[model samples]
Target: MPKVTCHNICDAIAAAPLPDGMHTKLIGIDGCGGSGKSTLARQLAQDIGARVIPTDDFAAWDCPLEWHDRFMAQVIGPFQANQPARYQRYDWHSRTLANWITVPAGGTVIIEGVSAIRQLFRPALAYKIYVETPRAIRLARGLARDGADAWPMWQGWMAEEDAYVAAELPAKQADLVIDGTQPLAAR
Candidate 1:
């Protein structure tokens, strides 16, 4: 795999040809929990003037990866039609769909999180990136952010992520694989 550093990612994206008939450049950043997907998405969005639609906005403690349908209906549908998209974000604290967010069409939009690059969205994506991090490091990061009290829940979520990796092989399909162990700046 070729090295894709934060410094050069914008240049790389600019150089890659978009698929024919694609009006919007949809980029998917997929990784297990705490693998730095969100971090990369934010930085890349800033650099490229893109909007981010996190899968976490649709995910919950009970439903991890099954939120694809909601994403398809709310985001992809409108994006395909070259119109603005709106969706309710699932608040982790309230456990409800809170706050509607409207993302304008055109330019780049990043769909990021665990299972963000699932098969259903691949045909529309201009680029796919997967972040690979060790289980121990990811668990440590998750515990730190979500607190140790959510240990059991985190364990279950990690198991689901493992199953997704086994079945989907997202990394194998990625146009770029980022090493989560290294800081993007260092890369």
Candidate 2:
């Protein structure tokens, strides 16, 4: 297992060359709740000038896994054909679908969330990163981030996510596993 601070990951990503011959490369970042998947994805995107497509932005709050068809139509289809892709955004406040988003071509596209690396999307990804953090620390972080009022629901959601991942075994299939508990050191 290779352990890295967050800054080190960013440094490594900045030094890496963009994939050859492809207008867009999809990177999947999957992790347990509060394991810092989004944070790392954002940093990587900033370092590499890549587009960050958060899976949360596409998913329904109550049913996150049901957006695979949307992802296929929006992201995968466009990148595969070397065309710009667009998809609707989920409005968390109104609990309704929002305006469309256009994903431009010719850079890395990071799809990040709990199930971003699911079996359905794995084949299309150029690289897949799984983030690991101790359960207790994750729960504490989640509780702090979401608040006590939302902790119960968050815990339930995590349980459901865990069950799904257990059946799918996403970690075993990932290209890299990142230790997310530690902060990224300044390089």
Candidate 3:
């Protein structure tokens, strides 16, 4: 059940039954910053041969959740139709759309990001996963990865995630809750 948060959540997801009438199993990895959403997504992708779509491709420092329209139009819509999808990847350093990426049709997909399991995505998802970690740990991990110079940006992103959580209730609505603090090998 979703309430049973644990490191072995990936195993649980693999064993769970998917909904019928879909071309692919759509999985979402959602969590606050440094909660290991992307890490879990990567692990799941490797485990299931799924393409991991990092929400970072669409995210920006000032507007963390602004990629909703592009995601819907590019990824979700095409996936639902059993058609390949393409997205213009956003370059973090340049702060611009740099390159394009493609997702093949009829394959498993793991979408990881702050709002990966936002309400709008529920209808298409086979499994809505929420990764939970302590705020302090999350912030530390984020800062470590993005560097200390990006501390303020991380804070702003966390604040945006906080608001989204309040409004969307992603954790409560998820099909699985993962203990992201755990090691991937153990998980």
Candidate 4:
């Protein structure tokens, strides 16, 4: 895999040709939990004026990858029709659907999370990114953010993520694979 700076990734996105009959460019940033997918997504969004919609907003501790139908109906469907995407964010704190977030039509939009680049979203994506980080580092990050009490939950989640990775092979499907351990500085 070729190592690329965030700037290079942004440039590639900007230059990438959109598929026929598509109005908006969708980018998927996929990685395991605590793999710095959010960091990279934010940086790319800031650099390129793209909207960032994290899959975390939809996924909960129990439902890891089952929110695809809702995602397709709320976000992808609207964007595909050149309309704004309005979807409820699943607040992890309350473990329920929360406030509505709107993503305007056209231009670039990023969906970042564990299954952000799943088979369901592949056809609409103009660019795909997978963040590669060590399992030890990822677990450490998770423990730091979620606390030691959440260890069992984290373990289960990690298992689910591993199964997803094995089944999907997102890194192999990615147009660009990035180092999650390094900070992605914007140009």
Off by over 4 Å in 3: 1-11, 14-20, 184-187
Tens-digit lDDT track of model 2 for 35-145: 989888887787777888888887754875678888889987778778888989898778898999998976778899888888988767778888888888888888888
Query: What value does the lDDT take at residue 64 in candidate 1?
Result: 86
Lowest lDDT 10-residue stretch of candidate 2: 12-21
Q: Write the per-residue lDDT of candidate 1 for residues 36-104, one digit (tens) a residue.
A: 999999999998898899999999999988899989999987888887879999999999999999999
TM-score of candidate 3 relative to the true fold: 0.90
Global lDDT of model 3: 0.83
Q: Candidate 3 on 46-73: residue-level lDDT in tens?
A: 7667888888998899779988999999
Q: Candidate 4, residue 9: CA error in Å? A: 0.9
Cα-based lDDT at residue 57, candidate 3: 92
Q: Candidate 2 at 103: error in angstroms?
A: 0.9
Task: Name the regions of candidate 2 deviating beyond 4 angstroms.
Answer: 1-22
TM-scores of the candidates in the order shown: 0.95, 0.86, 0.90, 0.95
Q: What would the per-residue lDDT of candidate 4 be over residues 1-62, giving only the tens digit for each residue?
A: 55577788988999987755778899999999999998888888988999999999989998
| Positional deviation of residue 9's Cα in model 2 after best superposition, in angstroms | 4.5
TM-score of model 1 vs. true structure: 0.95
lDDT of 2 at 164: 68
